[model samples]
Target: MKRIMIVDDSSTIRKLINYILRKKDYLITEAEDGLDALEKLIETKVDLVIADLNMPNMDGIELVKSLRNNFYHIDTPIIMLTTTRDENLKKSALEAGVNLFLNKPIQPNLLLYKVESLLEGEKNE
Candidate 1:
């Protein structure tokens, strides 16, 4: 079974993604912020990470940077989810190593597609 982490400050977002991925038979872990997600990652190995950009005590970009330094997560795909339409933020995320982006008010099908595709690519590598 594949494990995934959903990192967001909003409980609703976390719950929604958890529900969506759970239905697809993916193991889910929820984190309220990037800091919390980093802590969780230390203990578990997740195939992918879905994170929100704007978060307290560490944003997604910083989290991605931190994860990239860790040998265990060096090649793990990170999908950043956000409502921000700022091109600068998107550029920063890309530079920081976010593999994909998903806008807020998420479309379930797109999320699943990205998740499956990233995981499949990981498997192939």
Candidate 2:
């Protein structure tokens, strides 16, 4: 089973994503923020990461940078799921190493599709 880490400060958002992805039988890991995600990632390796942009402790861009700098996670696919419409932030996120940038209130099917695509692509690599 593919493992996915969902990093969001909101419990409701985390649960919602878990509920949606659970249908696909993906193993889910939840983190309250980027810092928690990084700590957990040190012990648990995930196939992909879905993170919120504006999280306390460490935000999405910072997390992406840290992950990119880490040898273990340098090639991990990251999806920034944020509600922000700021082009500057999005650009920074992409530069920081996020593979994809998705807005909040995302469609379940779309999220599933992207996750599947990213995992499949990684497998091919």
Which candidate wins on lDDT? Answer: 2
Runs in model 1 deviating more than 4 A are none
For model 1, give the 10-residue run with minimal summed lDDT: 82-91
Per-residue lDDT over 1-125 for candidate 2, one digit per residue giving the tens place of the 0 to 100 score: 99999999999999999999999999999999989999999899899999999988999899999999999899999999977666779989988999997888878999999999999999998
Off by over 4 Å in 2: none
Candidates in order have lDDT scores of 0.92, 0.92
- Give the alpha carbon lDDT tens digit for every residue of 34-56 in model 1: 99998998788899999999999
User: How big is the positional error of residue 44 in model 1, measured in Å on the Cα after superposition?
Assistant: 1.1
Q: What is the TM-score of each candidate against the true structure?
A: 0.97, 0.97
Cα deviation in Å at residue 11, candidate 2? Answer: 0.8
